[model samples]
Target: MHLGKKKAFIFIAIACVCAGVFFALKTSNNTVKISYDPNDGSSKTTTKTVYSKQGQTVQDLLKNNGYSVDKDLYYYSTSLADQASKIHNVRIVKKANGVITIGDKKIRYSSVQKTISDLLDEKNIKINKDDIVTPGTSTLLTSKIKNINVVRVTKAQVASSEDIPYQTEVVADSNVTQGSSKVEQSGQNGQKTVVSEAVYHNGVLVSEKVKSTSVKTEPVKMKVSLNPSDIAANTSSRGSTSSISSVDSSNASSTSSSQASTSTDSAGKSTAATIGDNTSKSKGVAEIKDDSKSATVKDTTQKSETSTKAPDSSNTSNNQAASSASESSNNASMTETSKKSDENSNTSEKSDSSTITKTSTVNIPFKTCNVYVSNLAKGTTQITTQGVNGEKTVTTEMTYKDGNLVSQKEISSTITKQPVTQVVAVGTKEEQTTTQSTDSNQSGTTATSASTSSSSASAPSSSSGNTQSSLSQYVSQTKNVTYNHKTENISASDFDFLCAVVSQEDNSGYEGALAVISCIMNRADSGKWGGSTAVSVVKAEGQFSAYGDGNYTKYLNGKSSAAVQAAVKDCVYGGVRNHSYYSFQAKAKTTKSVKIGGNYYQ
Candidate 1:
């Protein structure tokens, strides 16, 4: 029993010693090192050592050591063990509130990430290689950063096909009728494929560039055949199908045929059918030929009968009488010949003289219209639309008798083309001038204001040389100046509205803003689109978006920039000029165009 009690006492002593060692280790203090880095741009860092119990957790250690952690701030440690000794270093970082814009989404987030790359990763935002990020990925994020922008960029090649219109060509053909035309060849349109590189910003197309264009088929030109007479009329009014020389030639041919037929029957029969072909051919040629032939036959027959029945000396008187009759017949034949010759000449002359219908063109003068403009300087004029002379067709009947003009009467007159009116812009703006001169070469006036009369005082003829020298000196000393005019029709409110429209449409620089103002001014001046005045044009239905949606009010009342205001003054006061452009749009519809800012003008 004594030996068992001694062993038990030794075991109890060992247990108490082990228990004391374990409690002492658990209660012992440890030094934990902590380092904090503020992700701010200052790059500041601080280190601290804290006393902690071995069994205490990281949170318990910090709390026991009087360290406070903000809820918005995220804390981290190199080691996250429950035991204080395991955590040698602890870091505390600050988070920031930021708004991120990517694609079409705007997200508000609070994160402890120090860089843009880390923030995007934390938000699970995927980025492609071709995408663009503003405030680059390496940019540090801080509390001061309020917004971030990311552009989703994509590249692609697109192919499209279009048909090219065929051209029509006209050709003169003699085989066709005098006033007729026919199609010689059919026209065919060509096809071409265009390859373009399209660029998109956030799924919206920003630009497209043509990479290549290949022809799939060639175009064919249409050919048309027109008669010479039709071509002559179409080409010019002076040209004629049947000229005066041709008319004269036809008349001469008919006259020669008439003379030949009166002498013999050889040419008469051959040409009798073609006589009607000449418009001036007479019927006297055939009639005279018949009479001459019959008379000749009768005379020959009578002479033969007399020769066969010869009389004796008692019929000598009959012989004398026969001789006298023969002489009478000869004289009669001579008279007939002379008369025929005269008739032939007269008939030829009558054939040459015929009524001709001619058509000629006359010019009709165009009217001039003066449009008063306030923007241009006084006494200045600009031609907007050129004057064009119109044409009219006058049909006249000319009667010619004995190769002489008898009379000409107009049959009809019709206008072929309408005259284009001349449009001139006249300046009405008054200018301040120092003096007015009579010299035609001088333009504008001096900048200074004066009350000198335009006409100089009459000089004495005795001192003409001195007066001329003095006048030359006076002209040399004067300065020339120009003033811009204003439209008396446009009200103050309308002018402000016009400037506001320009500002809202374009944010580009001076020239870019000027392009917009010019387009509006051109539309107002043209008077073909909707209205003739500036305000009327703006208020026209379905024309401008700025006025329709009332967005132009944003830039009203001097809220626009200096560039926009200057552009307005330049356009309204004639400081800048635009003559061709009358229309503009966001997208270009024609190949030939001018691009300014984000709009296209043509």
Candidate 2:
């Protein structure tokens, strides 16, 4: 059987401590020595041997020695048992209280900011000014906070408000009242945010995140104004009244002349209007008989004088004068009608002026413009540009008409790069041995070439191929193995062989090693009566090493005896997995109990 360096060099480290041996001897088993003298300038010493029983630390040792462990002092040590692994010298400080601090990493909320930065600050630790804060501003006060360090930090802080645009909403306000609200869009009341990103004081964000929001705009109340034109039209039509007066002054004028006749006329025309004054009595012939009766006139004159005193018979001339008086009154009424026509004309003109003013409106040009851009990143895939290398600023971009920008943009660039991949040439050793090919840079073919590979680390590759196919089959099959198939009865040795092959120190390009492990660990627990080896390792409820704190890499690397290596080899060559791909249960435990299929001699 071929042995690979007898247990992988069985790495065990030793630390020599001669002084430690002496110190331990003095205080190994707790030892005591002390002296005190009240007398003037005199001293005494005494010694006693003791063994440490309860606590194993040096502080405990000092306290037992009657040397008060200083509360401010720190102590550190690496137990001999941890020598194989890296042994850290623990930090310790005696506290005023009974508890002592190891590294004194414990922090309180009041004394610290509950973040890595505040924790360091509380202890008076000064970091670079450019250092980034971690755990975020809102990290909880807990012992879980961890500080990641960097030499110097180049901070790029960006504070932005995503317009919380006044939470605009269109409400169908048939009857909107002031200070009232209609849930048009329910406005969600937009918010402006203060976003801060922190990097490691020296490194990138190792952990923690926080988010918060505040309302930027108060919701607008629903409201409306009465339509002015509707009110005005209604008022005018509902309240205005029209009137006309037809006064025929001629009727009153005729009434004066016909008053006496019409009152007692045989035809009874008293209520009817007169065209002219009608004769109330006929003219008497007193003038013609005046001379003949001269002798009798003396006696008759006395009689005639008495008759003339009675009443004048003809009344036409007096009536005509009365008609003239009525005409004068009619003329006064016509003057008043002319004044009213002038007043109405003025009122109509004023109303037309008012209506025209209310309807006039002019458009004000829109101050804002929009830019419809295509071929931009769809989501927040941080578009970064080198404006001033280390420090960058963000500015708002405003789109205006005529292709002009109202505001300048902050980082208006994008770059795209291809994905990364690695490659390997399979069956090359045989090709080199038989075909003798020239180097990639050479033109002529060479003599017989040997199959040799360099041990130096290869450079990171810059090539892209089909994601899985080209690289998977080339995986080195010569290395050791370490895995458990789910169920189908694969032996322990076969599994280890597969693990060994995939983990070859020399590269054979198996990009799917981790993927295979994932599949095996997550497979169904069907045929093999249980689950995969990966699941079985964690079958202890929650203590499975894969999911536990144990490091599988360390376990695999650590001290293995020669016998174990031999046993591992025995199963790989002729055991459960001869040369075929197999599937198994996902929960099958007992990896040591597994065997190769159809190949075990036992």
The estimated TM-scores of all candidates read 0.31, 0.14
Cα lDDT for residue 446, candidate 2: 47
Off by over 4 Å in 2: 1-95, 101-478, 481-533, 536-602
Q: Can you give the lDDT of residue 514 in candidate 2? A: 34
Model 2 C-alpha lDDT per residue in residues 1-602, reported as the tens digit of each score: 23656544432211235666766675434432222221111223233443454335544544555654443332223232222112213332221111112232433232223344554555565665554344343344232333433244544343434323222222234353322222332112233654545343333332223345555655442121212321121122211222112212223211111111112222212211111112234232111122332211211110000001111333222211111112222121111111112232233211000000011111111111011111111110100110111111111112222233222111111111111111111111110011134455565544556444222111111232111111111123423333332223234433343343222211111222332332333332322414445335333343222334333332132111111222222222212112222332112223532222211111
Give model 1 RMSD, 1 decimal: 30.1
Q: How well is each residue in 100-215 modelled by candidate 1, as lDDT tens digits?
A: 99877999978777788999999999888988888888888876677889999987786755455455455678885543345565555577887879777786556678999999
User: Which candidate number would show the highest TM-score if scored against the true structure?
Assistant: 1
RMSD per candidate (Å) reads 30.1, 43.4
Poorest 10 consecutive residues of model 2 by lDDT?
351-360
